[model samples]
Target: MEDGKLTVRAVERALDIMLCFTGATELTLTEIASRVDLHKSTVHRLLASLEGKGFIMRDAATDKYRLGYRLWELSANLSKEGDPGIILLPEMERLRDQLGETISLYVQDGLLRVRIQAVQSNQAIRRVAPVGARMPLYVGASSKVLVAFAEPALHEKLLASADWPTGLDQQAFLQQLSDTKLAGFATSVEEREPGAAAVSAPVLDRGGRLVAALAVSGPANRLTLEVMQEQAPLIMEAARRMGTMLR
Candidate 1:
């Protein structure tokens, strides 16, 4: 094969690895190697480079790999596709500055929540829910708000589907979603990821339609439930301000 073909094949394999994570957000090295049908050594090198470039991240506790934070910075820029989220960048940055934590924007797509934009915190130990990564709609703070504020059809579809991960109490989960909708916000501590906590609120358009869930996430130690509660108003205000910037 020509060198060009080899390079293209290499890029395709890397992309395959990224797509495989859609089904399994957290996967061990062996699991990924098996799923991608690649030699462990080859996959290891790809993962290493990807991690270095902030395209993938490894969980220290579980030794598993997941998506990382740099995708939006690379692809969601204003010029490339002109993502609507760019208009809210100033508000996201201000919230990050005021809260000292990662700020993320998540929009509901069917039963999934995709991180469309984010402004990460400066802390050395921080949570990284990668931009463009698809997350479970029934797991985290952002997910709760997204699901709660979603259209009734999509919301009911989620409630009826068996897509929810095991070990979750469906009854309590339903109640939580109800509360989130009523309160116009949600909070989670180590719910989606261990040692990570987040607070989230719905972003609504001028027509009173849900646009996204704006969130602040960081290490659980720093963003304890109490601290998040105290700062909840800040995020809610920022989310509302961002919503007004949109249609």
Candidate 2:
């Protein structure tokens, strides 16, 4: 247990050092130590280990450290076969460019909806939901879409067995899912986070099985319920393309 804790702590410090390079092309040893608030010798040792693994490299001529090729190569692999991001990223980018909002992809994980990929808006005041977050299946537009198209047994189990939030009417929620399935999309205004709103549509595989939910979200002041309603057709089209690409 002691050894494991030490290993984890070392990993955390290394990550802190790497994060100091964010938005920076290169950083000197002194700059890294200052950013992470660690001793010069400690920072140097951590940097040496990271450099050995190709996670970071120090330029001998300039004495500055920068991200290495290993990170870039690993990032490139996200687009390879069997990754959902590969099929959805192009459409996500197009939507972000056209709608000027955050585009995210979510898949149902058990009874919860987990964000798997995201293309955040470049706007200064934008909504940002972290990827890999497990959100409630009963709230938010993306969650509604995922639930609407979920497998019948699992869907029923979620409704009957899962603990629901207070003041949520069960019958009304079921009706909402029915409506979403009929319209092939879902829209919400400030259902999850205050001042945040989103619209989502279901993406199905070639066999017409529910695969994921593609959503566009932003500040409620800009991306209103009306705007999302008007843009539903386009969102649906993009989701359709995403579904088609999934084997």
Candidate 3:
């Protein structure tokens, strides 16, 4: 092959590795080699290059590869060109009214979650998270919801790579993610921001891909654990409604 053709083929093979993660979350070297019909050595070389560029990440705990935060960032940028907040605003408003708390929409951006839109509470004392504010994905209810639905490989990668918050060890944190996924929602009290409480649910697109997290947050005193649990269904319902609209 010509030098130019060789370079193009190399790029295509790298993209193949990325494309493998579309419907799946993680893959081992052997699995990737088999799927792509390449030798394990070739796949390993490609994976190394992709990892170097932040297009992929390895979970030390599992020895599996997953799509990295960079990929999420690029995908987010594409989705932001046509914002979901416009379509979700009405539902967010309804949730805020129902709970008398603030409703915010969040999307994963690299290792952080960014608030894209929010409807503040009517009460005098409330948590006000400004749009565009970023928070660690390992902490808040909204962030946790995003992490819960994310690829298991991502969970492993985060545990192995990131500095977890105080009082949350790796196993406990993984269990929290597991529980969140099983319950279809997440709740946090002073996890990310002090004296703030929140309950969040996943918002998925028609294809069942996680599009964002819908959350209701307020002062911790007003939104206790029981209160958050009680309000979980409402937040979940609102997220479902938004997902339907997104579809």
**Candidate 2: segments with Cα more than 4 A from true spot:** 1-79
* lDDT of candidate 2 over 1-247, digit per residue (tens): 9999999999999999877765477999999999999999999999999999999998999999999989988887655776787667988999999889999999987878888889999999999867767788988899889998887787678777647876888788888899999999999898988999999999988899988999999999999888999999999999999888889
> What's the CA error at residue 115 for candidate 1, in Å?
1.0
Clashing pairs in 1: none
Q: Candidate 2 local accuracy as lDDT?
A: 0.89
Segments of candidate 3 deviating more than 4 angstroms: 1-81, 165-167
| Candidate 3 clashes between residue pairs 3 or more apart in a chain or in different chains | none
lDDT of all the models against the reference?
0.87, 0.89, 0.87
**For residues 20-126, what per-residue lDDT tens digits would candidate 1 score against the true structure?**
78667799889999989999999999899899999999999999999898876776554834355788888998988888899999988878889988898887888
TM-score against truth, every candidate = 0.71, 0.69, 0.66
Q: What TM-score does prediction 3 earn?
A: 0.66
RMSD of each: 7.4, 6.8, 12.9
lDDT of 3 by residue, 1-247 (tens): 6999989999999998887774467999999998889999999999999999899999999999998889777866664444788788988888888889999999998778888899999999988768877778888888789999988787877777646666667787778888999999999888777888889999998889999999898999999999988889888888888998885
Which residues of candidate 1, in runs, are more than 4 Å off? Answer: 1-33, 36-82
lDDT of residue 217 for candidate 1? 94
Weakest lDDT window of 10 consecutive positions for candidate 1: 75-84
